[model samples]
Target: MTTTVTTRTVRYPADGLTMVGHLALPAGTGRRPAVLIGPEGPGLSDAVRERADALAELGYVALAFDINGGRWIADPQEMLARALPLLDDPERMRAIGHAALDVLLAEPRTDPDRIAAVGYGTGGAIGLELGREGYPLRAIGTVNGLVTGRPGEAANIACPVWAGVGSEDPIMPAERRDAFAAEMQAAGVDWRLTVYGGAQHAFHHPTADHEVLPGVAHHPRQAARAWQDVLALLAECLPLGEQAGRAS
Candidate 1:
């Protein structure tokens, strides 16, 4: 059976500012599992929206959320100015996440309890914060976003986490990776990490349209493989079929 996915723009308030997000719904009727997606520091773009569309095609309600009032940051410095601080404050990130999540949960097509969260770059850290704040997510996936958080908090995360990063990523080097692993291990959460060799930060992105920086480029092969890893994680933790019922 072929299904047609639908896409719509959603606007909601977060941190006293309006956030614009994209929601994608699968064809046919029942309630479906959802994935709350966050984009990199440069803000939401077609890349993340396409991810939502892809998930919807796979029968999952997906939302590609924004952090900067529906705007995409075209400058690296500006993005860093806004994102770097939020990364340090888990509470603020959770607030932004909660608002985006509310948009996803409000949709009649979504199964509120069967949702997962995934983020790329700074967005990835925000999704992890949602899990850390006990959002009841079924799974969490991060690509180049394994940034650490306040200590003793990974224990709050209840679902499995999957993180993928470039082995050559200076932003997230060996020491940081080791620390993240230690944190997850101490919290006893089911976690996994895959470091793609010869790739740099944000390697999943196909181009440098929004911002350009050294050590930040795309790797076609690694990007494709990382996407496959994401799919596998979602499949194992938030499987589709049988549970696809219309929202009540």
Candidate 2:
């Protein structure tokens, strides 16, 4: 049977910033597995909101959190101006992610112990930072955000990580991807990286209202393939009938 999915806006405070997030809840009683979504550098977009709703329809309480204090940026330069500094500051990323996690857990329908995080671009970096900060996540999925963490910090990641990126993405090039893989390997974490052939940066993002920058176009075929990979990761790691443990 198909269950109803409900969505709402949630306002919260994080690191002196008033964050606004989209919360999606599945129609059911008691606790259910939850997902935390991090939007790209452009902040929370309609596509990200829709992803949350889709997760809810699949019986996962979902929250697509804000970055940039609720501003959805369209200018590429403006987005880089806001995102570059935050990417360098892992603590700030963790602050925003944890704040969103708190709101997700506050929902009576959410199963606090069973949660995963999926993010894109700048948001994907935040999700990885949360994993590095020792958050108890069953799985971490990222697209175009294969950012390597601080030296030795990835040891804190307690769950498998699945990352996807466009093979032609200039932002996360071959050197950067190799570095990320090295980090994960050294930390003994189970991680996988999928490179979508001939795609550009942010290929998974749906077409936006404004024009995208060079090397940042959407690839529909690869986007669909990436989503399926994420769903597979979630199913394997956060199965509805089982509870996973936190990092030690």
Candidate 3:
């Protein structure tokens, strides 16, 4: 079935930076379950747009959020410098994410209770933060996201979470991954973490160059698998069509 998708740039609040995003809605929808997609780096990219389209094709209203003031950082060091501060201030980051969520919820075609979040890289961390902050998401998905903030914060999460990371991700080591998982377990949160062996950071971005991260290499196979897992989890929790119904 052919779906209608629209792209626009929106400014958040007064004096806040303008965010460029794409909104995709399925045909014949009063209000549909929405998926808020966070970008991997400083801003939105075409790759993220493709993912949003995929979600929309599955019968959802998908919004790809731009969090970096609509600027692109092609340099890894520059990107890190910009993202590191966000990791340090979880509250501020959460507010930014919450703002984006508010935008999604405000959309007339979005079902507030059935909203879900999915992010990559820094965006992944934002997704986890939103989930931990009781954002009313049906499910949350994170990819190669660093663990920030205190472990106890996981107690606030009220929905199932699925996290995907590369076993060889230099940015987020395997030991840290285990520690994060342990912390979530201790907090009694329903969470699952998948580490793809031999894959590196940004493995899902086929166009990403290895030189971009020096030693990191993208594994197309693992990336494909991770995408499938994310979609499956969302489907299980949010479903589509009449199955979604009205979120309670």
Candidate 4:
């Protein structure tokens, strides 16, 4: 099937700053299920746009969000400097993400009831925050995302969660992963954690540099698997169609 994908630059407020987002919409006649794609560190990149394209090809409207106020940081220290504060400010991140959600839901061709979110790196953290705040998403997926923030954050998530990580990731260790899994279980959330063998942080990035982030490498096989898993989760949890009682 042929699909059309369009990109638009939109702005939202986050932590008192204006954040820009690149939204990708699937072209068709009726409303389509939507997904919020959170950005990886270094803000919006070509890799993110490709991901948006991939999602749109799968028949979902995806918005690749801009964090860090649309600024790019080439140095690892600079990136960390900007990311650290946002990671600690979960509430603010949630507000920003929710604002983006509002934009997506307001789209004329988007199905608000069947919304979901997927994030990478800091973006994943934002997705987790949104899930914890009880957003009405059918599912949430975090790819190699950090597991810091708060312990009570996962308790309020009402939908299914899929968390993918690298087995050799030092940033998010095995203990932390176990703790996160335990918290999700205690919160009664349907959750799955997949650790890809020999994969490290940011394994999905096609342009990832192992020198910048040691032990963090990208594997095409793992990335493809993760993408397929996300698609399956979305299909199972957020199918596109009208309900019997809904007015047409």
Candidate 5:
């Protein structure tokens, strides 16, 4: 642990909604590559904020962008009520993500040229839409985002993408996964997917307090392992430390 990670709350506008995002800064940093994080369908939580802090420990500026109007949803139905409609609207999704990106960009310590995005569930979908809208991300990643987007629009993605899902995730069946993979291939996207056996939806959450459906549960082992994979994705794409070397 860096032991000196600092965080701040930011409020911004997106899609006519006032959004709140959390920013985590690394210890002893010059300008560094930035990461934008999207939360699960229920919205931002300690889980997502902790992920941002972890990224800070890795020496990157990280923002856990808020959807769900800056509040956590405890009811599964409520989560779907808000998330589904946004998921259906690509432009709206991109708008929300772009607002968060702006927040990341405004920071003096963030290197705008080297940025990536990672999201869970609905947030993951938003991150993909950000790429599909040509956000200049170095990489995009999602975990169980229920992948499938507007037809023929994926060609706009300009960065590598990584996605993970549970093998038993009913919300993301094999066919949908296949479709997402096919879309990426057709678009010439560098993409990869990892399916963790016996895990269910939201397995990376690390706690059951957020679980409102039997279909979703957290797997600690898988969560730790998946974080490693996400870290590797960032290292390969943004390389926070290497950006300074390259700049010099």
Candidate 6:
């Protein structure tokens, strides 16, 4: 693993809009495992970019892809106004994820076959959509992403899926969490779900610069734990220097 990491801004077209993404690369030889990062409802922010860089430091090429084109809306209501419809449409989310995947794969440093998707909030839903669309991901990890996929479509998920959410998150209440777990279970997918006690929605984004809505607050401790869980998943499913077999 390389300690030095490099990052860059990439622009690509998706869903009739020009999306901007942050790509992070680790310093070393050969192609390396890659991760696609999806930002929360506020769109791509510095927090997401830093995560990509952190992944790069761990020797994985990471791309923090943008939503809402290149804009970042800090107003909670406005953000929801823009994100709600898109969240309801799984195909659109899948298209966005695929576009970002294309960008990640085009990079010379990325190992196309050893790839994973991790997302937060709306971005997490996008990652799940990618899994449901049969993207051959090594694993899928979501934080506070309570959205569920089409009925029976989870059967296409070829990789292990992991999710983290706050126990008190009203947006991702017990009912929704149960439904998501049921979907994965009924599809016979390898999956796990962790509920962070005493935390609220979006607990993983303490670095967010916006005024979050009610029921959404950052819990630094749980956020760190969730991140460690994500790292553990990658280590298990997409370990570096090993050409681990994955669904083709």
- Top TM-score prediction, candidate number: 1
Q: By lDDT, highest first, what's the ranking?
A: 6, 1, 2, 5, 4, 3
The C-alpha RMSD in Å for every predicted model, in order, reads 1.8, 3.5, 2.4, 2.2, 1.9, 2.9
Give the alpha carbon lDDT tens digit for every residue of 19-125 in model 6: 99999998766688999999999899888899999999988899999998999988888999989999999989999999999999999888888899999999999
Residue range 1-248, candidate 1, lDDT tens digits: 54698899999999778898999999877789999989998899998999899999889999999999989887878988998988888899999998888898889888888999999988899999988888899999999899887888899999999999999888888898999999999999999999999888889988752248777888889999999999999999998955845442
TM-score of 4: 0.92
Question: What's model 5's lDDT at 172?
Answer: 88
Off by over 4 Å in 5: 1-3, 209-211, 245-248
Alpha-carbon lDDT, every model: 0.89, 0.89, 0.79, 0.80, 0.87, 0.90
lDDT of 5 by residue, 1-248 (tens): 45478899999988777888899998764788899999988889998998999898888899999996778988888888988898888888988988898899999889889989999998899999988888799999999995777777789999999999989777888998999999999999899999999888899996653347877888888888889999999989988558565432
What TM-score does each of the candidates earn?
Answer: 0.96, 0.95, 0.92, 0.92, 0.94, 0.95
Model 4 regions lying over 4 Å from their true place = 146-149, 241-248
Cα lDDT for residue 47, model 6?
86
Query: Which of the predicted structures, 1 or 4, would earn the higher lDDT when compared with the native?
Result: 1
Tens digit of per-residue lDDT, candidate 3, span 96-129: 7887877787788887878888999878888888
Model 5 lDDT vs. the true structure? 0.87
Identify the superior model by lDDT, candidate 1 or candidate 3. 1
Candidate 1 ranges with C-alpha deviation above 4 Å:
209-211, 242-248
Cα error, residue 247 of model 1, in Å, equals 8.4
Task: Return the clash pairs for model 1, or none.
Answer: 30-245, 30-246, 31-245, 31-246
What lDDT does model 2 reach?
0.89
Candidate number that wins on TM-score, 4 or 5: 5
Clash totals for all candidate models: 4, 0, 0, 0, 0, 0
True lDDT of residue 211, candidate 5? 41
Kindly indicate the candidate among 1 and 6 with the higher lDDT: 6
- For residues 126-193, what per-residue lDDT tens digits would candidate 2 score against the true structure? 99999999999999999999999899999999999999999989889999999999999999999999
Error of 2 at 197 (Å): 0.4
Tell me the RMSD of model 5 versus the true structure.
1.9
